[model samples]
Target chain A: MTANPKGGRYRAWGLIVPTGVLYAVTFGIPMAMLLSASFARFEAGRTTPGFFLDNYTRIASDGVTLQVFWNTVTLSAQITAVGLVVAFPVAMLMRRAGPGMRLALMFVLVSPLLTSIIVRNVAWMLILGRSGLINTWLMDWGLISSPLALMYNRLGVIIAVVHVYLPFAVLPIYAALRAIDPARENAAASLGAPPWRVFVHITLPLAMPGVVAAFTLLFILSMGVYLTPVILGGNFVVTLPMMITDVARNQYNWPFASAMSVLLLASIVVVVALASALNRAFSPPRND
Target chain B: MTERSGSPFGYAMLAIFGALVAAFLLLPLVILCIQSFTAESFLSFPPPSYGTRWYRHVAAAANWREAALSSLVIAAIVTPLSLVLGTLAALGLDRGPMRGRGVLYGILISPMILPHIVLGLGIFRIALDLHIDDSLLSIVPAHLTITVPFVVISVGASLQSFDTGLEKAAQSLGASPLRALWHITLPIIRPGLVGGGIFAFIMSFDEFIITYFLSVQTRTLPLEIFSTLRYQVSPAIAAVSALTIAFSAALTVALMMRGQVISAGRIVR
Candidate 1:
């Protein structure tokens, strides 16, 4: 609606064309290929040249795949829940802290985001190994007689996933908390509401958008996360990403892998779609 | 804000909790630094003897050096490519009164939501069909798929907040459109561009899953470390990890000193 939008359209095209072409070749076309390949027939570790529903049939009929799918959903839900709980208090402190303390906390909190997940997992293995740091410390304190199985299990993966993705949850909630006016909380307290009551009634509802946004992000990221689970969950723990890789590489079943990939992508899309619908229905509007 | 935070009990709780979270976050980096100094090679909780032996071992590994160099070269290529492309797209979104802008913007950033393995596998399939999978050239596109979305999001944020009146004023004063952009628009958006570029570089440097599918002739440091850990880890693995952590910390400090938040981080803003 601005003046000279004709020129604007031409300018936009010039600026956008190169990236468009690049993505067309790299991402757009590849996605099309993925979809097409998913429905292609599979034979002897190679994709044949026609459409088939064998992949879908197998995915539906195989009880183990269903179990693994449920397991993945459960683990991701657990990680999102735990990460949100742990991140809430920290985000509150970050919002309320003085400048110096805030900067220090931000640096520490953001460090893990910058550090490679590989290194994080490697260090987790070192700390969670049978005779690792936790065991050594417990022994020193006479807390336990034998080392515990901490790494290469479901519990370890959950812990490490939470650590890696914690910041993702905290930052959004912190931003929301920071954006809240202090006057509202102060007014509530001045009107005789207790501190806890002020927080529960005023602050929590206002920060719900951020909480939802954070959960959505964490859930999606958890769905795609491969390295954390691979490093910590070992062989038995098969998330979709891991399973996709196994079918593609180890089994040399590209079509089946493509099918799984499509399923994973669809699941995440569905999650966000459903969440946003709920968000639209439930979230209070901001007049600002 | 005043009464509660001033109370000793509240202050103590917040401070202690903050410190505990920081320690939890840095626990791995701290442990890696310690492990790199251990003299023994078999991996023990406490070092039998503390020395620079593992660091020295890492210094001598030719493959490790090559992997590091390859990573740098790829990141060097990816950063500028992503920055230019991303900035332009952001510019378009900012300046153009185009229809379906939302649709266009969504398409531009959809790769961010796509799973890495899916993108990698899809790109790999295409590359294999094109017979380009055996070259380092092929992997750059794969890396870009992941990094470009970050650039668009970051640079787009900066562009959205930029004032357009200055550029219009420059144009009225006889400055060319490109000139106004160069002299006014670009400078204002420099922080965004720089932040996007840094993110593009780091993401490319650390990317392994995409490279895993696409890498045939070249290997990056993360790929090397992954294999090393998966098959057999030497004490040198610890050293390599420590060195990368040091690099990340130094980069972080440099950005912090300049007061730049590198807003392109996947962490929600």
Candidate 2:
């Protein structure tokens, strides 16, 4: 049955109208314009509207673009993988802790998220710099006579990116683990299954949805990461966002930059779709 | 679940994981705080001497002050506007029997999932075409696109759990629709609205990409910090970072506290 008796549907329509107009003007039109701009040419302080495929062709053939594509994919995957491994057990521990301890841990875990990305990257720059804490501590302990190059490298970029995005991984996994009844694990244990076996066969599978969600979230975030790589990678590594920035803002090549952004968007959508499909395929069968 | 009194390995593993995660999260913020006290003019770690010179410098720098002010002003404007608009949208969508509601909601929330860099570029091009480029007005609309979805989700969740029967009862008691909404419905959802608005404010304040693109004449705090990092690494930036961190952390704590109070009230009821 319908909730409203009168033909007062116009009241709801009235409320939606303002928001719809704003969304259309701000989001919808621009997104469509961006798609069209990817195919047009911009030169000599003028944009020539046309159906040109040259921008996409350049992206396909360019070595830098290919490297950026691969780098973006691999880096996103690596961060998602590493973050899950680190976050899962921590979330489990958080689940079992007392209320005070859980709150304290949550605070600590989410503290990094509160800071600006620029600040977080700078902090990493200090810690991972040549004469930074890690190198200094290593030298004092006689682990190495020379300071290792930690900052402005791929390893450093991954470390910093993971640091910033870890909360995204932790929070979802923590929520999922909390939802799983502890009694299920106890039941498995009472049925003579070992702890490791129970975790592997039951708990891990149940938490797969969380894993998928975290992976998708982290992967998407990592793909668009600009500041971390710009700060930590120095002139060494370049991601798609950095490339897009250089092309669009620095060089004023709107068409080429639009093309690259469109490619990045398409790739992100494809990855997310694949993830959803995989999650559905592996999801536990429902008992009716 | 009783605490297990066995397995030293379990306790050791827990301790190690907790310590590592804490270190990973806190190290950067702590290091940034420490570096702000460095005596040198450059970004030299393990400074020979410690002082608050950078804090003084940050206090005096006009550009830094201007950027911080612009960020505050923009966030102040964007937060409340987005909240009202978002709440209206959520209420309408939740109450209505609109066709393709799921699809419409997905479309509405799509902005959150779209990359900021792309949005930044789109807005950059749009503003240029519209001749509104490099203005504070431009930044507000861009911030709204990101903030509105958050308000919709949070407020919509609250609305879903609310009892509409109360509204009907109020109507039977001769209360007008507007009056019922004002006196009854709005109070019940106030917590969610506040929480969501705070979330939106924090997101806009910490936003970097959109501001970096859309802003040319005006710089937000994040844009200023980004520019400084490119030319010179200094302790003043760290001080700014520390300030932003403290502000956001306070807001987060307040939101979480409000959440606890609301849930506790639910339990009592």
List TM-scores of chain B, every candidate.
0.89, 0.87
| Residue B73 alpha-carbon offset, candidate 2, angstroms | 0.7
A119-222: candidate 2 lDDT, tens digit per residue: 78878877888877788889989999999989788889989999988877877777777767666777777778876787787778877777787888888889
Give the true-contact fraction for every prediction, in order.
Answer: 0.49, 0.46
Runs of candidate 1 with Cα error greater than 4 angstroms are A1-5, A285-288, B1-12, B231-233, B262-267
Residue pairs of candidate 1 with colliding backbone atoms: none
Between which residue pairs do clashes occur in model 2?
none
Local distance difference test values of all predictions, in order: 0.81, 0.79
Candidate 2 residue lDDT tens string, B172-201: 898888899999999998876886787678
lDDT per residue for candidate 1 within A1-288, as digits (tens), equals 236768756667568888898899999899999999889988776678568998888788887666777778888999999888888888888877888888887788767777788888888888887767898789889999999878778888988998888888888888888778787778788888876787788888888778888888888889888888998888757888888888887787888888888888888988899778867764765646
The alpha-carbon RMSD over the true interface for every model, in angstroms, is: 2.8, 5.1
